[model samples]
Target chain A: MVVLLLTILQGGMAYRQQAIHGLAVTGLSDQITWGLYIGNFTFFVGVAAAAVILIIPAYLFHRREMRRVTLLGECLAVAAVVVALLFVTVDLGQPLRIWHALPFLGKLNFPTSILAWDMVVLTFYLLINILLLWYLLYKKFCHHTLQVKHYFPLIIVAIILGLSIHTVTAFMLSGNPSRPFWHTAILAPRFIASAFAAGAALMIITFQILHRFSRFRLSKGLIREVALIMAFSQFISLFLLGSEFYTALYRHTAQHSSAVLLYWGTTGSEGLTTAIYLALSASLIGVVILMVRSWREHVPLLNLASVLIFFAIWMEKGIGLVVPGFTPTPLGEIAHYSPTTIEIQVTVGIWAVGAMIFTILARITIAIEYGHLKAIK
Target chain B: MANSRSTRRGFLKGTVAIATLTTATLASSSQSDEPTAFADSIASFLQDHYQRMSKDEIGELLARSERRAKREHGVDIKCHNTSAITGVTFGYALNLSKCKGTRRCVEACVTENNCSRNSNMENIRVLSLPEGTRDLNQSDHYYGVEQKVPEAGRWYLPVQCHQCDEPACVQACPVEATWKEADGIVVIDYDWCIGCRNCAVACPYWARHFNWSKPNLPAKEINKNTHYLGNRPRMAGVMEKCTFCIQRTRKGHLPACQEACPTGARVFGNLLDPASEIRYILENKNVFRLKEEQGTQPNFWYYTDV
Candidate 1:
């Protein structure tokens, strides 16, 4: 409770600063306009979209074990979407004028601008997950059985919308033909691959904690199943990373400057050299461990691998991806960016808010599912 | 049930107290730009998009803008909503051989545009390139003024908003706050912009700039003559760029940069007029544009007198 209050206080203070001073308070310039906030926004969008992994197995494959924990996936997505939206809002230069994007009221350039499509898809994804969670939880609370016909369609839509959200976000980044680093055909596939790796890792960790602390009983087999998904996704993510490197490094063209700056340093600017190497190492080690049967079956080792994979993806897909795209600006200026204290405060505050929301939702979910809290007879 | 009710009441009370304290703190700490009249603030807040506004509404908005200049900067300003003149597509051309690496045009543009002084926002950039190379990678953007003008074996390239017919910035704007005018100059409705900076990302030439903070326009420095889409003071958190000196060009005057060139290297005229200098340059001299492969179809051109 105290942490939640502190989060609110700090977040509000930082937001007020952003509101008064505009985006100048952040460490952004004309050279590198989008920074930490956008990075986080992109990462959380992936996380939100990854809920489809559980949805596919639980709903389509009709796996009873996966179905038991699908509620957790939807709840996590809700929190992730909320966090993503907050990042976008805080990053905007004119937060108060956000209504300008509304249809009819303000002119939203749809069909042409990928950003418009991203906004539409993200909103739909959030709403669909919320609706699914509400219906499922309410039914459980009232001791009612769900008819497959009633929700099968909604589940299928959520699954498709989840992919759409991430794909649209990837398109938003790649659509900028001027920025050669992000303007690639492989970006969307790479995003989904990395998202599943990170998302499954996070689920593994969350499931472990819940099983230990509450009446939630997740079998070891279930944990192993999630780890399997993480391993395959991580492998595909590595392959795509290699493909991007080969494409950029082979020709060594002027258009490859962003990748060159990212992997190595240029002149006085070290770029993200050290950070990317560390992420690559973590990714390799985690993938190796997950790929091994004995290591994956071990509970504590599996948990450690999950943590490492999550950190790797966070670093790789977050600042590591975003900052490099802007380093060698389109005009060949090498601009640098480092988030301000206020920016970090606001980011952490939003994460804390997300955690709070997830905890409350998870507690109620557990109570209803376990018959601890329900409608009276 | 009684125990639960009391706990709920206590929780509600705690929330209220926290909420009140937060509001109070925020109110006290924020540097509020509270308008003098409540009704004016409401009207400004609820102002419709520029395209949706009627002529009377635009008039009221211009008056309100003038009033805002008076209140904020203590300047008497005239905000004109000038429409484009028909049968004239404004175009610009620069002679590379005659151009020296003097930034006279840069300073002239800043002074004319009413750009925020604190942000160091300039509409023009003059890059010093070696005599042989056309590669922008080898160009120096921050050419020092301490050196003598036209240093040996160096050529100067002055870049600004090209005002493309198929501008990527216009397409990248999610809120349609920016578009190319009938006269071929791209303009932004600063009030309607949400400042996502997506347009800046989409612009290949780095023409667009954002207001990082409230513009610190001094009354003495403020230009009394301003167009609604050009040279008008902008609020914090909006995008602004070169409008090709729309206020002056629309009034039958040359752009400030064209007037400022010492060697008469800059030329401006209507592209549709065959007798115009810009058209003559296009027909005669070896002309080119930066990033022509991007298909932006920029109206601005660069040529050599050789």
Candidate 2:
């Protein structure tokens, strides 16, 4: 609770200047316009979408004890969605004009603007998640009287809708012809796989933390299940990345150099390239090491593997995702930009907000599940 | 599952039917923006996608549009005024064949467009392309920092907006903020635009320029005789591009570039009319649109070895 409060304070304090003045507080120029907000928005959406990979195994695939930890994912999802929204608002040149996006108030540019669709889909998905979490918690509150089986179909539908929100976002980036690098058909699938990779890692690490605290109890099986998923997801993300590289290189088309530059730095700059290379190497090594059951049995090594996957995917998605789309620009001037101190602070601020959301929701869900602070029956 | 497929088929059929109806309606009276104004006179009128309004429904709306144009452009010059097909658009043909490395059209576009009149803000660039090459591969757009003119065998292609028939930039704008007029002119509504720059990205011609800073026009340098369709105050953050001087062309005046073209390499005219100088160029010279396979179908055609 205190950690959540501290995070909220940090996020609020950092964002206060921008809210008071305007986007002038940010270092985004006409070139290198999209900064960490877009980066984080892309990253968090992937994390949010990855929740379902675990959700499906537990609820649909009927993994025992998946029930106890699935609520943790729902909590993570709430944070993810909140952070996603907060990041977009921060990203807007005129955050106040955001009210204009609402159809009742302002014109909704449909189909042409993926942002309008993002607004619509995210609003629906958030509502579905909130309702689902409440229904499950409320049932637990009332002495677990309500039949959980009746809600499974509805839960499945909600999961599909939630999945669509992030996939549509990937499509929004990929569909535009202007962004040649973003114009990949494989973006949605790649994003989903990456999301699963990150989410599994995040869940395992968080569960380990909770288990260490001795406040809450979760099955060791669930931890291993998620770690295993993290292993596969890391492999898949790297594979798709390789496929993208192969197509870019062998075709020897005009688009090849930018992708190579994106992965391994153009000329003298080692930017997202370093992250992509380091992350790929570290995660690959971790995945290979973790694939063995005996090594996976070691909690320290498991956590080590999960942390590496988590950070690697973050670096890959955050900087690696945004910069490639911009390089070999429409004019083909590799417009270089380094995030300033303010930009880094603002990114940290967004993380703080996400952390705050996760913390509060975790408290509430934990209380509900273990009957700590039971809801009024 | 069978029912779902049938439903999908039904949806597709309905979509196609709607599309056909739309195209038919558009073709019937697509001559002018007046279709909405005289909708009662025309039959089979389905409402537009912007909002469903008939000719009778939008009299006040159009007045607001005109008012917005006046406020934005700082002139009451007839807004959304369609051009008549009967124009003898006097075009200038640049004989790239006879051209020296003279930067005259560069000066012409500057003066005629009433641009950043201080000579620093000229939109038209005389990109010096190298000998034996038609593409920009040999061109030096990055030729700054005291580079010598005619960099060893470089031929100059005075590159500007090609005034495409199907402009990709026009379609990318989410707010219908930028559009092409009847006179083969692509224009932008800087006020209506959110400056998301989807248009800037969508433009294959790479003709568009963004107003990074509010244009620094000195009081004396400011062209006060601004036309709504031609010269207007551009906003910072919004995208702008060459309009081929619509304000001047619509008034039956030659573009500044055409007037200044000592080589007469640049041509501007109504492509529909066979009598225009551009039409003659089309008939007599082998003119080609840049990046033909992309199918942007630009109105501006390039003539070489003039």
Candidate 3:
């Protein structure tokens, strides 16, 4: 409840102010037209995707220890959706005119536009996740009026659809033949793996905090299991990232200039480009530290490892997607763009808003699950 | 230069031999003097298609154009209303050997088109092709003499809108803002444009530029002698491109850029008139169009002096 005001009122209003002003309040330009907003969106989608990683282990693999942790996935997803929507809205040149892409439904560009496809799929996924969440929580609160079995198939499909949605969004920027730097075949896999890794990192921290605050005890073995899932996913995530770098380094693709600018800053300040490089390196170090046998067993060390991986993935997957894309333009000219102060303020505000949403959501889910919010029959 | 060619040709064949010597008489032949035909103007030209605007329709346009001149510029402008003659189209040929890259044509275009000093009106792209490199593909667009200008093994090429027979940009515009004239010039209607920037992507040459804000113009610097055909009032948000100086060319005068070339590398003409300098150049010079694989059929061409 104390964290509510910081997450909701202040963060919410900051985003509202940004939306009304258009992108003028942000740091986008002809050179670096995308920024922290896109980075956050990409990062949050991975966090959302972490729900599936949890779902796969609990439902398909039926890991008995992962059952009570299921609701946390939906809560994280809800937060991610809120954040992703915020970023996409603020990124538009005419934020108010986004409806032009969907004026009264199926009126203009139909099949050809990938942007339009993202709009439809993301909305559907958000709604289905909402229903899955509400139905599950209602079953707990309404004296057995509903069953989890009723929405099992729909939840299963939603998870698959969610994975594809993030992958398609990556292709939206990558598919353009003109944007050579973004034209990578490995972009989709990298996005999926990073989304899982980042999502898993978020879960570790959120679950930890939830356990400390709530009456319900998240079992010791279950906590260990979640950390193990995060660790394995982080390995694949880092491996895919390495493969992409290898291709860019080995091949003298004229398009390699984009990665080069990222690895080595251009003209004085490397800005966010240099920052991402350092952060990714730190994340790799965190991964190594967490790999030790005793780290996941102890609460203090696990917390430290989780924080490191979370920050690492946040830098590697989140900022990595956007800052590198726009440094070099389609004309092969180096166009350096940096985020402004207001842009940073607004972005921090959105993340806070996402936290506020997750907080409110987690509170509601916890009350229902523990019978605190039970209704009189 | 225009009068000398016609007069000399007339003298060589004896002026009396051709019954119609109106070619030498600008006062009797030009349409800039006509005004009344527009005062009681009506769309009397049979609502013809763009390709086949009848002479009466062309006359109606000329009349409407005179009215527009009075309305916009407070001065009269005219259209000669000359039809492109078959087997008589003009083509331009430049001896690449002569171009010294002095940038005289670039300046001439700026003065003639009345472009905003900030926008830099000229579309001349100077590229220095390296010496002993036959691959035009590898040549860089920006060039100095050392990088591959007129050095021991290098040459320069300036490329612009090709005014293609099949233009992708005109076809791609959701609104009918861009159109091609019969004489091969792609033009834009600045007022009707919505600034969607669809045409910018569709263009193979990136010739089109979007006016993201209200144009920075000095009202006094606005060219008062405007034409409905080209260089008129441009709106805040729309696409704009070179119109091959339709105002000058319609009156049968050379483009300002062609007249500005100190090296005489640039050439201008009707592709229809084989008897003109353009046709002579096309037949003699080894001319090439940029990105010919795209099949744009552009009006502009480049070639080596040799």
- Across all candidates, the chain A TM-score values are 0.97, 0.93, 0.92
Tens-digit lDDT string for candidate 1 (A315-377): 898988888888677667777777899898898898888888888888888888888999997
Lowest lDDT 10-residue stretch of candidate 1 chain B: B33-42
Would you list the rank order by DockQ, best first? 1, 2, 3
Cα deviation at A357, candidate 3, in Å, is 1.7
Sort the predicted structures by lDDT, highest score first: 1, 2, 3
Which parts of model 3 are misplaced by more than 4 Å? Answer: A1-26, A103-108, A145-148, A251-253, B1-306
Docking class of 2: incorrect
Off by over 4 Å in 1: B1-38
- TM-score-sorted candidate list, best first: 1, 2, 3
The lDDT per prediction is: 0.86, 0.66, 0.63
> What residue runs in model 2 are displaced by over 4 Å at the alpha carbon?
A1-33, A212-214, B1-139, B145-148, B157-167, B180-184, B207-217, B225-231, B254-262
Query: Best DockQ goes to which candidate?
Result: 1
lDDT per residue as tens, model 3, A234-352: 77878877887887778756557677667766784466667777778777776775677686677777777777778877776667666676545433335566676667767777877
Between the candidate structures 1 and 3, which one is better when assessed by lDDT? 1
After TM-score superposition, the amount by which residue A342's alpha carbon in candidate 3 deviates from its true location, in angstroms, is: 1.8
Q: Score the docking of each candidate (DockQ).
A: 0.36, 0.10, 0.04
Write the residue-wise lDDT of candidate 2 on A279-367 in tens digits: 78777877776788889878888878888888877877777777667666544455666666555767777787778777777777887
